[model samples]
Target: MFNKGNKGLFALVLTLFMLTNFVSNAQEGESIFNSKCATCHAPHKDMTGPKLFEVRQKWEEGGAMEGSLHQWVKNWQVAAATDPYAKEVSDWAPSAMTLFADLTDEQIEAVFDYVDEQPKGGAVADAAGAAGGGVASNIATEENDFGWIWYILGAVFLVIIFSVGGVKRQLQELDEDADKQVKVGSKVWVFKNRKYVGIGVLVLVMAGVVWLFLGLYQIGVVSSYQPSQPIAFPHDIHAGINGIDCKYCHNSADKSKSAGIPTTNVCMNCHKQIQGAGDQVEKIKNIYASAGFSPEGGGKYSGETEPIIWNKVHNLPDHVYFNHSQHVEIGGIDCKQCHGDMTKQNELPRVVPVEELNMVEGNIQLTRPTLTMGWCIECHNVKEVSTGTLEGKGGYYDEIHKRLLENDESLYEEYLEDGKVTVNELGGWECAKCHY
Candidate 1:
């Protein structure tokens, strides 16, 4: 009974309706996954939880009870208690999954539906990366060209000045009478001022020697070396504005020598909701892309990821032996004592110069190059070995202090001549301490 045009309109309406419903479900699923599931489950990769790609089909094939996977998502402990398959899955990750008793069966199904659609290779931001690369290349080219142009101009000017001077000299020489007067009189005039000339030469020689030593001192001293990071992660915003602790991200500082860079997942802990604006949006998008995430339409994992290649800002030679835990956990030294106050830092951290570091409120003033042997030795000589720090985590420092006071009282007194038992007294200056 319907006309052809009406029938066509009905089909179009139906198609749009289905698409709208599908997109809405996916968005809802993405929101739920990012909020509750992302901390553990990755779409294709095994994390704290097994990969959720085709997970429902896998569960069915694995002989899981009908609808048991949904129940597991709702409340894992209950599912583990009731079903043999769920119990086996729970053992895969030692850390227990949080109970999501509020999640409906339909919601769990939607999450699975969303996850199954994730592309295996993930979202490649080749366009964005290529654009950035092109911009970087153009800027580099411009900088090189700018420098070469100035150099060329300088050379041209130098040639012109010398040519003009030589021509002027030739013209003067053509006046033979003036040239003879100049040659004969000039030596006598110089001979009269020979004492003043000698004194001037001596002053110039001393100045050159002083300058040479100063320049030599700066050869290996790389202070304020600020390398560009892939992301301009403002420490002032995270640490000062938001009050996120340094240890929260650089979790290894108290455990290892390197303050480890936080993985992209760590950045997504808050960034899942905090999609930034302007220039930062591009940088944060790079994080999302690396974490296999789409930060649009509520967000979903794409299963593709690439690591952010960060340039090292602080580098120590292979021969040097440094342990962060020794200073951080045992000595109870504040991070600001070495790395300047991050709360005030607007850009990525660089090696703060000795002069600038002294300007900081509480840092011990040192006169040597940053991170040099002299700097370490100077800090050891000056920093007080207090009772609280000496009675550290292992009580080894306390025992050492006690032995110094009891067994080697005279040596202890001599060390305490400056009114404190500094690191220098505790065998900090031993060659084997750092070298080997």
Candidate 2:
């Protein structure tokens, strides 16, 4: 403390500590928000809950009682009873705020800090969209470069062979007894090595045949196939940042064979309040047109409307029979199992590759192409009939288990040999299961 150097080092250490602490708090806040608050609140946007940006400052400016904000988070009713400002907050929304009694004051402050620090409208979306675009571009570039890479390698191999042959010829010419030795013609050399040449040709032919068949098999497999849509839907904004559930839009996934596309009325439910800005204005205008909503003169719906024709993304052939309800409600498969993470998807929905699907956490690793018979077979072979235990949840599988247990104990025991019951054990792989 006495020396200048010592003071400088102390200052530096203090600065570093502050910075580290700030980062740790921010990260912790984000984790907690994602786990608990993200479903309702967004930083700069009003979702189910009001926007949290500057909310702490706002409460202070609004003459809220000291420590009332923290108390409100823990139990709004207690805060509202004691503070007039908290009572006003309670009246702001029809839906009640969920109580977070377990959260400490420090945790609530951290969440507010994180929210207040966030960049306003579209910044997060822009960054996420840029990252997603970069990944897609890189994947496309790699696929395009693949054929040229093999060609370049083949050319390099040819050069090496030619260079080795040149050295051998030079050495032979430098030999004193080279004139006495006879050199064979190319045809003569090939004739002498006909057995090896024949074997090589046979191997090449077999390889070509295999390659051709593989190419033929891949004819209809369209992984990463993104078709242009009428409306450019930003799934990142809705699903990722805003935390809209997949089931909210695709509401029929648990009831019907298809996960039904959301109607224009559903879009209007949110867009009626949020008219939007910038490029989003044009997109929202399309929704308005489809829903017959006019934002002008206090936002009324006109009788005239046009239908929005959405292009189907995941299409299976007619011969293949799949039930969305059975998989979603009964089997309890997560949407991300086949669809990958739609939250990060900025572009229109595409046929996600099996490799990408495997990369997603909790997905069963698959070797076959996406949307193929082999892929389905592989999933059915591994995917358990029930998650963890089959005790409480009652469904077709439970009934099947009961029958097997009562009628055929040996068969049930045989099914349990692997310590879990899979879909394949219950006729998932039977010819009639998938086939019409």
Top model number, lDDT: 2
Give the TM-score of each candidate.
0.56, 0.57
Give candidate 1 misplaced runs (Cα > 4 Å). 1-186, 388-390
Each model's C-alpha lDDT?
Answer: 0.66, 0.70
Clashing pairs in 2: none
What is the number of backbone collisions in each predicted candidate, taken in the order shown?
1, 0
**Candidate number with greatest TM-score:** 2
- Any idea what lDDT model 1 has? 0.66
Flag regions of model 2 displaced more than 4 Å: 1-184, 387-394
**What's the true lDDT of residue 214 in model 2?**
51
Native-to-model Cα distance after best TM-score fit, residue 323 in candidate 2, in Å: 0.7
